[model samples]
Target: MTGLLPELSPGLVLAGAVTAAAASLWLLLPRSGESRAARWLGLALGAAALAGLVATGRRLGGLGEEAVFLTVALVAVISGAATIVTRSPVYSAIWFALSLTGVSGVLLVLGAQFLGVATIVVYAGAILVMFLFVLMLAQPSGLAPYDRVSNEPLLSAVAGAVLLGLLSLAIGRLTSDTACCAVAPRAAGPATQAAAPAPSAVDPLAADQVARLGGELFGRHLLAVEVAGVLLLVALIGAIAAVARGEAALEDDRRLAAGGGRR
Candidate 1:
């Protein structure tokens, strides 16, 4: 283990950040009667992880762009984590809404104007409102028992950390590769067509953006879009079923309490 200790390089910083995030998630995830100390510790670890990640990141050219991107990214990550960790379904849903806003900001910064706006309009404005209505209809008299415990918290944390680390490493490698960042010259062969610009430099906004997106969705990915629509419909149906069950359970609980008091 001593031999495995790496230098305090950017890679090491990222590794430490990933480890801290995992530990923080493990500590912060909803549990039965958690102590204040554990919550504080988790918050501290989470902050440390955020700092570490910031320290390891390469500058994104302009300071204004970098700051804006960083701010939105932080909001998204923090809110997403809060959504996962909050015991109250209401608060969790609110955090998820905030996360969606942050995600929209990030997409806008990346030049995907339509997608950015649509994410909030579709998810936050529509789907999330529906979820809130379901919550209102289905919420129990008190905190539900299932809300106090997450499914396999330890495994989930470890899996998330592993995935984060893997993605970080892949991104780091991909960005550091000079070829990936540079646009190569067009080939001289007579058969060669005009070379396309680098993906990062492509003016996706220059086209009839919404129409192109619609064409893509309804053309090549039509089946996928249909499947996603079906899934959303099923999820809405499930929410209705859950609401009915919750109301029934609440009724049963109230009847039992009334009978006990009378006896």
Candidate 2:
């Protein structure tokens, strides 16, 4: 079917460029400045997203079946890779954000604005901010201990490869080799009256596309959404517990000073 082929527009080019640039800057910064591994991973993922945007633009004339397939492949590869290759808690967090953003861009290209916005808002904005906050607060002691994590680099590599394989399979299956299903005859009428609608002003909440998203998550993917909420709750509790423990330890020292006759 041909109906799924998306119209290519100059706007796609601009969006691609902007996204690519943002991701590149995020990835390229030095660790001395902001964790090297994280920066490179973020940069690599950003590059991948840009590549997807470019591929999407090229396919804009209509991502014929083959183009759609290739586009999805690029996305799966990049996002999966980003998830695995990033080290450093903060860097991993940023790469995770990049992957989420990349998925959103792919959805946008496919005309799924609602899904795209949800991915970006939930994953990139809220979830990521939570993670970054945790990492910053932890200020992990001892670079030597952190460096020892590399001992499991092989395990990380294997896990990443498996993730990539699964993502590739999932995307490949979702896309058809044939162009999107064709538009029905009656649906093609009223070409003249089909003027393009004017764009609206940007709204922060509008970017979340909340209504469409609320319905989908609560209606179709109810179980998945609930599970995610539970996971988030667990993470929040754990974080609070950790901070409390650190503060309690500090308080013990203050009491020791006050009661121990400090000069």
Candidate 3:
């Protein structure tokens, strides 16, 4: 599998291998009941995530421009996985926020600065806080509930096959055209020397990609983004109402108890 990896960056290769091993171990961890083994696995996954981040940072040479992109990707992968495997809802939410931030960082690296910022603002700043607030307000005064959802083997198998097929198709599409390939060399200018130097020369298809993305997003996908906003607003409203109701109910109960009303 070492030979199968690309020669672009060794950090990415190491990250991928560590990610795969962590995921496999995570899958094998017990789901239903509390397992000491699962807790240890989570710790191991977190360690691997830190290692991946360090490796990526080193490859990108510290906190340089490229380092930001790779760092975010590494952090997102690790945090996202940690969110699921952790037992505490609050901790999970924190990890999820970190993961979303990482994703936004990746988008920023891809030249989608606006989208990346929006992603972080919406997911981490707003939605994540709402989730944390709700959990704190609604948490029952008892042990946390743990109910493992079982999957049907046949259905799971079918789903896995479909996912694999779709992934293969996606890979094929991505590698199909030369335009979608790696960044191209910059065009030389009249006054420029023999070596045209540009640190971030735009990719050949960058303009086209941006145009297409804007067209689709502002045209066909416009409704989807709008709908997402509305959904988030509704969720926020619902959370507020739930919290208010809970507080009111608690007040009423307190009043009743103070009055010594008994059957």
Give the Cα lDDT of each candidate.
0.87, 0.57, 0.63
Model with the higher TM-score, candidate 1 or 2:
1
Candidate 2: TM-score?
Answer: 0.42
Task: For model 3, name the residue pairs that clash.
Answer: none
Stretch of 10 with least lDDT, candidate 2: 196-205
- Which scores higher on lDDT, 1 or 3? 1
Q: In candidate 1, which residue pairs get closer than 3 Å at backbone N, Cα or C atoms, i.e. clash?
A: none
lDDT of 2 at 134: 76
Which candidate leads the pack in TM-score? 1
Can you give the TM-score per candidate against the true fold?
0.74, 0.42, 0.52
Alpha-carbon shift of residue 81 in model 3 (angstroms): 0.3
**Residue ranges of candidate 1 with Cα displaced over 4 Å:** 1-7, 183-208, 211-263
Off by over 4 Å in 3: 1-66, 147-169, 176-263
What is the RMSD, in Å, between candidate 1 and the native fold over all Cα?
Answer: 6.3
